[model samples]
Target: MDPQHHDYTADPHLHASHPVEENKPSVWKKLGGGSLSISIIVHAILLAVGVVWIFQIIPATEQKVDFMPKGGGGGSPGVKEVSNKKQRATMTNPNTPRMAAKGVASTFTLPEPDAASSMSSVGSLSSGGLSGGLGGSGSGGGRGDGHGTGFGSGTGPGLGGGAGTMSPFGMVNPNANAMIGVFFDTKQDPKRKPTDMTPEKLRDVIKEFTNQGWNERSLENKYYKADQKLYQTRVYMPVMSANEAPKAFNCEKEVQPSRWLVIYRGDVVAPKSGKFRFVGAGDDVLAVRFNKKNIFDHGYTQGTTALYVPGKVDVLAGKKEDREVERIIRGGAMRVPVTLYKYDTTANWNNALGGVAVGPEFDVTAGSTYPIEILISEIPGGLFGAALMIQEEGATYQKASTGSPILPLFRTDGSLPDAKGKDNAPPFDSQGAVWKISPTSRRDI
Candidate 1:
């Protein structure tokens, strides 16, 4: 028995244990044995496949993408491109007329055409032979015919005709008279009545007062003479308001608190002959005499008719009155005498007298002219004055008449003086005095 040469055929277990293995080549040995480029190519292909497989297995990251316009000019500078979906939704076929937009109607229908006979009568409408459209020109009694001129007339004076008759003409002078106001001072006596200071007494006192000389007087006589002397001497306008007496005579203090008198003398030239009305108002007494007749007299209690102060006495207490008298006169100038008297026994704040004689309704054929005089006096005076206005009867005093005075008579010093050298007379006729004129001669009818 040799140890090195053991019999293998005898042991089946030993043969099973030492089984033969096949000699497959290693990966590096096979790679080393192939051509370099071919091996490289094969390896690269394998690597590329492996990389692609690995990329597909892992999740890929997203990247941004920008789409460009077809023409390459880009979009309009300021305009934004609307989405294709919106454009398709709003688009209409060019060949077909669109009735409305997408949301308006699901289906469109065409309208039926009108029958030809419906418009066949259009040429028959016409306006008969009328002028200016609407109705004919001479329809409503107007002067014009459709083709001719209308009625046209000339202008005339007054309403319907050129002028009418029965209008007064010319104006008398307002400042024709020369007025003198003489003021006298009287003692204040509370017990004195208006009757106590009568016109007779005032006349007698005035005579004595004017006769008093400046010389030969005792101490007591000096006081009496001084007290009785005329306090003021001045010319006054014939027309005066009650309040104007003080300014006209310079006797504001003397007139209201004392006694006074005034005389106005003038010549009135009546423009024509007609009935005349003498109207007057006074606080005490008012009288008027024309053509030597006592035309008006309203003493404190002696007249049948009286105009009392509105609120003073309920039954004509005689404190104040407005009186009037009417008379007939011939044409031409004549004398007019006016007398105004006031007795301030009640110490009233208002003390004055005034009157106006609507001038005669003169006959157009008669001459025109007259005289005027006025005498105004006040006794126991608290306030006193008078005024007289003369206008034609039934004829309003015309601002344009020749006798009208344009400017006021008051001087710069508030004194009303008589007409100086030349008087500035106003035209007497106003618009109310309308006169008809002869169409031929153009003279007043």
Candidate 2:
């Protein structure tokens, strides 16, 4: 048979019969092609696949990932890895202390305890007026005694029975042990001082605390006495939870009274003098009175009240202003703060009663009237012995009523327990004398 004629492709069955039996040779050699060249070609194809995977496929897959969560889905998995790397880099930066953000909260250092003592020493060294060392005054009422709950309560004047000795209308003595500070508006003009009080100067100062029921005659009049005075001294307005008055006279049985301070502004003749009094409308005046137990007892009840000038005055001709400041005067307490709302007709006074207004019921059947209101500020003790009101105006507006000398009311010892107890003590000395507070001094460190 010719080698070309006996073709391997044409005679599959005949070729099988003449099988080559070289089983001992390597498997690669058994094949027709050289083993080295075939192996090289296979390696080249694998290398190309690896290069595409590392350089092209991996980077392209990384760019297509979505790291952050979107539309609240299951969340992206692969993108989070790259985000974590960035966060780590930011945390390790040395130039930034924590996060280099300007809006970070700051820490404040507490003043050393010695700083307070040093300030006290400096106050003692000053030449200004000094308040003598008078013990505090205390007002106490006990509830639930041998008689019954809220029954048989006995209340004494002052904390240590000192109120009886001090006149309600009298000014607290300047040399008393208690400390007092007064700030009044007297310098309505730039070229004046508050202490430089002439008749006109005093009028200006009075108007600062109260812009109702003020007049030139009232300012100059010495005979107005305490009744005609717009703001009474040492008065508090209190509101009771219920209408039932405190039955006991003791410190505990007595509760807060529902009361308010009504102020009127404008000129009126002195109660003693029938003269026109050269009074102007729109005068500053504070109206303060106790409920039920005379104008002296500062008890109050929680109810709606209106404070306004009942009488009509010319609005353009210096119309007088009237205000109603609410306060709560509980037994054993000192001062009360009243709110003076700006005159408004559209305001809902009904909503404001319990929410904003703190005083007792004052009849205001007439609708849409302007009034001032004040809330009660609780200060322990019956009287603030060291009370001062320095008249100042123009330089500083006398927005607060407690700082006026004419007001007679003052803040008591700052630390006062809500209810009387063993810790309770008087704000002034046991003698029930007048007091003056040491002047305040400021130094920049």
- Name the top TM-score candidate: 1
Q: Over all chains combined, what TM-score does candidate 1 have? A: 0.27
Model 1 Cα shift for residue 193 (angstroms): 21
Q: Whole-model Cα lDDT per candidate? A: 0.29, 0.23
Tens-place lDDT per residue, model 2, 1-445, is: 8886767767888888886878487776777558678888999999999997888745432223222222111123333344665444432331221212244344522222221111000111111111111111112222211111111111222111122212211122321222211211222222222333343433333323233322324332322111212111231221212111111111112223111112221111111211110000011122222211111111112111212222211111123332223221222111133222221220222123211111222322222121222212111213111111111122233222322112112222121112122111111111211212212321100
Can you write out model 1's per-residue Cα lDDT over 1-445, one digit (the tens) per residue?
8978989978789998997898999886687755776778999999999999999989864332222221111123322354565333332211122232334332433223211101111110112111011112121111111121211011111001111100010001111122222323333232221334444455444334322321122212312112211111111222223333333333344334334444332223333455554433333333343433344433231111222222423122233342322111111111123322221221121132221222222233224333233334444344343233333345444232223222221110111222223211111222221111112321110
RMSD of 1: 34.7
TM-score of 2: 0.18
The stretch of ten residues in a row with the least summed lDDT in candidate 2 is 274-283
C-alpha displacement of 242 in model 2, angstroms?
18
Off by over 4 Å in 2: 1-209, 212-217, 220-223, 227-236, 239-354, 357-412, 415-445
Q: Against the true structure, what is each candidate's TM-score? A: 0.27, 0.18
